[model samples]
Target: MADDPTKKGPADRTRVSTSEAHELRYWSEKFGVSHDELKRAVAAVGNSAEKVEAYFRDRSRDARR
Candidate 1:
């Protein structure tokens, strides 16, 4: 996926909160992924929240390198 952080529109930005950011950070750390990778996975999964969660759960074992 592309690395454009601006891909999400302004309205979409409002959907995330500080707490959510912290949560994402925690998950990213636990899963051994960059925050950007977590964001990309979420974006790729779109509205499917389950798929987004599953992506992290399934990929956590893979080394980042």
Candidate 2:
């Protein structure tokens, strides 16, 4: 099995049919990073599940502001 967390299997990848820009914004908000930053982070971290969860937790904490 492949070890990359970001590499979704064929069944896991779904088409959302949304605007590309909107989708990017949604991911940035969901991941708690700027659009450009998120792209870089995903590339650097390979979208590990654990990393994503940690990002969410950190973002949640910051959201209290």
Number of the predicted model whose TM-score against the real structure is largest: 1
Q: Which stretches of candidate 2 lie over 4 Å from their true place?
A: 1-19, 47-50, 53-65
lDDT of model 1, residue 35? 79
Q: Which pairs, if any, clash in model 2?
A: none
Model 2 alpha-carbon miss at residue 32, Å = 1.9
User: Residues 9-62, candidate 1, lDDT per residue (tens digit)?
Assistant: 223332321125555555466446777886787677653446666777767647
Q: What is candidate 2's TM-score against the reference?
A: 0.41
Badly placed stretches (over 4 Å) of model 1 are 1-19, 47-49, 56-65
- On lDDT, the leading prediction is 1
**Local error of candidate 1 at residue 5 (angstroms):** 23
Report the backbone clash tally of model 1. 0
* Model 2 per-residue lDDT tens digits across residues 1-65: 23343533322222221125555555666556677766655565555545654656776789997
Task: Tell me model 2's lDDT, rounded to 2 decimals.
Answer: 0.52
